[model samples]
Target: MSSLKFYNEEGAGQQNSDLYHYSQAVVLGDIVKCSGQGGWDPTGKLDANDVEGQVDLAFQNVNRVLQAAGLRGWEDVYSVRSYHVDMDASFEFVVDRFKKHCPDHRPIWTCIGVTRLGLPEMLIEIEVEAYAKKA
Candidate 1:
């Protein structure tokens, strides 16, 4: 059986992970699972004020988490789940952004509209599962 491997970005140990008690992502063998990421920067500050900008930053954070786990890019992602504050407003933008990022390899996607996220200022949260064969 393979053991779990965890990845947390720099400064996260003393900042986000310590305060929130969560790792950015974990890997088990060929599969990688990541915590939902918001538009917050490394310091946990909201980087984007609008939905489009927030969606862009959230994807960047997800990519950062994936790279930390030794994955190349979103091309390794097989599935994605996003939580949005307003489905009506966020739905279109989210789909468009996903297409923009994963233009060649599209991951199975699930988007949910929630009453709110962990932070009130956050407009969207994204989580992903990716796979890469042992090399």
Candidate 2:
């Protein structure tokens, strides 16, 4: 039986991963699940007041975590869950970023609206799940 594999990319995902006791991504067998990532930059500072920038950064963060595990790219992503502070206004940017990342194929997507996230200034967060033939 294969054991679980946890990946924590340096300066990726939430800065409080250690305090929260959660990894950036976990892999078991050929499935990889990543924690929700906000718009925080590599230095862990919130990228405030720019929803488009935040959306782009969030996608980058997700990809960074997936790459850390040496798994398939966005093409292998089976599902994605995106949380937005204001869906009415931010939805377009979200779709644009998603398409930019996974241009060839459209994966299952879920969008949610929330009043707040891990931080007060966080505008967007995204989580992804991918499957591969081999890890």
Best by lDDT: 2
lDDT of each: 0.82, 0.84
- Candidate 2 local lDDT, 1-135, one digit each (tens): 248888877874545677687889888778899889888788877867888888888888888888888865677788999999988768998888878888898999999999999889899999999985662
Q: Worst lDDT window (10 residues) for model 1?
A: 9-18
Candidate 2, residue 59: the lDDT equals 83
Record all residue pairs in model 2 with backbone atoms less than 3 Å apart, i.e. clashing. Answer: none
Q: In lDDT terms, how accurate is model 1?
A: 0.82
lDDT of 2 at 35: 89
